[model samples]
Target: MPTISMTVNGKSVSGEAEGRTLLVSFLREELGLTGTHVGCDTSQCGACIVHVDGQSVKACTMFAAEAEGAQVTTIEGMANPDGSLGVIQQAFQDNHGLQCGFCTPGMVMTAADLLKNNPNPSEKEVREYLEGNLCRCTGYHNIVKSILAAAATMRGEQVAAE
Candidate 1:
């Protein structure tokens, strides 16, 4: 096993992993960061999404060795330093974006990436951006609304409650 060192959630972490170890496995089992879930091993579901060097990637699609020196951000890192919900997370709660919650982490990760590139996304763009993330519950209208609200809040605008 090779020892991999990476910055996870703004903390330096290192662990021994085999070449075939998935990033999600390393995160969950090795580091005990279970927020980055393993929804589908095939990468079709975006539940394992995390930001590697600020871009969202499916953890299931990469080997731990590939992430060895990268900066990884999981759902655990999305919170404010003071331990409050991050803007995106608060927006989801305010807008009722999640149901069952299995898909919320991936949705939040993907939304963060989308907002990083496009600070203000239209409803269509939010829907298009989230096509890769699937939610078995909450038919997606609320998710789209939540992302939009988060974008608005992140842009320093008021989030009018729905």
Candidate 2:
């Protein structure tokens, strides 16, 4: 076993990981940050999405040892310092973006990445950006709306009432 160290959610942390230990496992089992769900062991689902070095990466596809010295941000980190939901999260709740909520964390993380790159994404663009994430719940109408609203909020623009 190797001791892997990384900056997780703006905090420094280290844990033991086997060479085969997935980053998702390390995050959930070792770090106890279970917000990053393990929907599929394969990379087909984006439920284990997390930000590594400021880029969204599928935690299940990466080894914990590979995240050494990296800066990782899990869904648990996507909140205000006071524990309130972050902008994207709040938008999700406000727009009813979730149903079973199984995919909400991944959707939110992907939206964050998309917004960071394209602060104002079109409806089609949001749909395209979310291709990797899947939700067996709603038709994604409200999910798209939530991302758009979050984008507007992040841009300091007023979110028009639906």
CA-lDDT, candidates in order: 0.93, 0.95
Q: Can you give the TM-score per candidate against the true fold?
A: 0.98, 0.98
Residue-by-residue lDDT tens digits, candidate 1, 49-100: 9999999999999998899999999999999999999999999999899988
- Give the total clashing residue pairs for model 2: 0
**Cα lDDT of model 2 by residue, 1-162, tens digit:** 779899999999999999999999999999999999999878987999999999999999999999999999999999999999999999999999999999989999999999999999999999999999989998989999999999999999997776
Name model 2 segments beyond 4 Å from true.
none
